[model samples]
Target: MMASARFLIPLGIFIAVAAFLFKGLSLDPKEVPSPLIGKAAPEFSLPLLNDFEAPFANGDMTGEVWLLNVFASWCGPCLDEHPIIVNFARSTAVPVVGFNYKDRPRAAKQWLNRHGDPYTQVVVDLNGRIGLDYGVYGVPETFLIDQQGIIRYKKIGPLTQMDVSQDIIPLIEELSQ
Candidate 1:
C-alpha cells in the first residue's frame, strides 16, 4: 500500500503541472486584461509633440471615439506597428491619438519624420507619468476609447493588419454607433 501511495502522489503532481502548462500554452499572452476596461480613461494634459505651444488634454476628446497608441522611438515594436497605425489614421472611422512615452523629443520627431506621422494629436509623456497612470506595461500598447471617454479595449502588443481588420475596426464601428 505504501509503495502504491508514493507512486500515485508523484503521478498526481506531474499531472497537475502538465495541466497548468497546457492551460498556459493555450492562453494568448497579448490578451492580457486591463482593469481600466469599461472605465473612464485617466485624465492627462501634455504638450503636443510637434507644437508644444498647444497643449493636449484628455478632456478635449470627451465626445468622440478615438484610439490612444502608446509608443516610443526606442521601442522596436512601435516601429513594427507604425504602418498599420498610419493606415488607420488615414481612415475616417476614428482619430488616432499618440502618447509618446518617455522619448526624447528630437528622436521622436525624427522617427515620425522618417516614418509617417499617423496621429491626429501627439502628446509627449516625457517622464512616463501619464503612461503610469494608464497602467502601461510596455510600448506599442493601444487603447480604444468610446465616445464617453471609457476605455473599451486595450491591445498589448504591436497592431497587426489582421488585428486591425478583425478586432479593432469592428470594435470601433460598434462603438461609434
Candidate 2:
C-alpha cells in the first residue's frame, strides 16, 4: 500500500504541474477582442501592392463599411479562410482590404492570384508592424469597420459561411445604415 501511494503522489504532482503549465501558456481566443472596435482605425500610408505611386491610408477607408482581412501565405488557416472570403466578396457589395501579414511580396501575390483575391486593395505588411498596431495575435484575423471608419467587430479564426451569413452580414447592414 505504501509503494502504491508513493507512485500515485508523484504522478499526481506531475499531472498538476503539466496542467498548470498548459493553462498558463495557452492563448484564449475570446480574451483578445479587437482594440480598434468602437475606435478609429490607426492611420497608415501603405503603398499599394504593385504600385509605388498609388498609396493608401486610413483616409481611403472613409464612407464605406469595409473589412480588413489579415492573412499570410505561411499560415495554413489563412489559406483555409481564403475561399470563404472570395465567396463573400461575390455575395456582398462591401469591400475587403487585404493586409498580407509578414510574407514575401512574391508569395503573397502568388497565393492571392492562385486562390483568387476578394480584396479591392491589398497592402503588404512585410514586418507585421501594422498588424502589431492592430493588436493581431494570429493570421486569418478579420475586422469589420463601419462607414465612419470605426472598427465594429473582429473575427479571430477562419470565418465560416454561417458566420458570414449570420454575424457578419447583419452587422454590415446595420452599420451601413
Candidate 3:
C-alpha cells in the first residue's frame, strides 16, 4: 500500500502540472490584463515628431476621446497595425495620438513617410521614459482614452481589422456619448 501511495503522489503532481501547462498554452498572450485600464493615463511632455521645436503634453488631450498608439520604427508589429491606425485617423471618429517609443526621430519620420502618417500628433519618447510610465511591456500597445483622460482599454498587440471594427469603433461610439 505504501509503494502504491508514493507512485500515485508523483503521478498526481505531474498531472496537475500538465493541466496548467495546457491551459496556459491555450490562452492568448495579447489578452493579458493591464492594471492601467479605467485609470488616468500617465502624463508626459515630449516633442512632436513633425514639430520638434514644440513640446506636446498629455494634458492637451483633455475634453477629447482619443487613441494613443505606442509604436516604434523598428517594431514589425507596429507596421502591421499602421493601416488600421491610418483608417481610424481618416474616419475622424477619434483623434489618434502616437507615442514613438525609443526610436530615432529621423527613422520614425522616414517610416511614417513610407507607411503614411496616421497620428494627429506624434510625440517622441527617445529614452522610453514615457513608455515606462505607461507600464508598456513592448512596442505597438494601444490605449483608448476617454474625454476625461482616463484609459478605458488597452490592446496589447497588433491591431487587426476585426479588432478595430468590433472592439475599437464600438467603444469609441459608446465613449463619445
Candidate 4:
C-alpha cells in the first residue's frame, strides 16, 4: 500500500502539470497581458521620418489621448497591418504616432512612400531602445495612451479592422470622455 501511494502521487502531479500545459497551448499568443497597461507610458524622443531636423517626443502629447504604433520596414506583419492603421487614423481625432523600429532611414522612408504614411508624426527608433522601454516583443504592437499619459490598451500583434471597431474604438471613446 505504501509503495502504491508514492507512485500515484507522482502520476497525479504529472497529470496536473499536463493539464496546465494543455490549457496554455489553447490560449492565443497575441493575448499576452502587458504589465504596462494602466501604467504611464515610457517617454521617448526620436527623429521624425519626414524631418529629422527636430525630434518628436511622447511628451508632446501630454494632455491628449493617442495611439503609438510600433512598426518596421523589414517586418512582413507591419505591411499586413498598415492599411488597417491608415483607415483607423482617418476615423478618429486621436493622433497616431508611428514608431519606426530598427530600420535604415532611407528604407523606412521609401517603404512609407510606397505603403502610404498614415501617422500624425513618424518617430524613428534606430536602436529599438524606445521599443524596449515600451516592452515591445515584436513588430506591429500598438498602445493606446489616455489623456493623462497612462497606457490604457496594448495590442501585441497586428491591428485588425475588427480589433479597432470592437476593442479599440470603444476604449478610445471612453478614454476621450
- Pairs that collide, model 3: none
Scanning candidate 4 in windows of ten residues, the lowest lDDT window is 25-34
lDDT of 4 by residue, 1-177 (tens): 999899999899999999999999989976778999999999888989889899887988999989999999999999999999999888788799999899898998899999988899999999998899999987889999988889999998888998899989999888777
Model 2, residue 77: displacement in angstroms? Answer: 0.2
**Judged by TM-score, which candidate is best?**
1
The list of candidate 2 runs beyond 4 A from truth reads 1-31
Off by over 4 Å in 4: 1-25
lDDT of 2 at 8: 97
The residue-by-residue lDDT of candidate 1 on 1-177, one tens digit each, is 999899899899999999999999989986768999999999999999989888999889988989999999999999999999999888755889999999999999999999999898899999998999999986889999988999998888898999888988899889877
Q: Over all chains combined, what TM-score does candidate 2 have? A: 0.80
* Comparison by TM-score, 1 against 2, better one: 1
Query: What CA root-mean-square deviation does each model show from the true structure?
Result: 3.1, 5.9, 3.5, 3.5
> What's the lDDT for all of these models?
0.91, 0.85, 0.90, 0.91
Candidate 2 lDDT over residue span 10-118, tens digit each: 8999999999989978867465656577998887888777775787886788998999999988899998888899998998888899988888888888888898989
Worst lDDT run of 10 residues, candidate 1, spans 87-96
Ranked by lDDT from best down, the candidates are 1, 4, 3, 2
List of clashing residue pairs for candidate 1: none
- What is the lDDT for 25 in model 2? 85
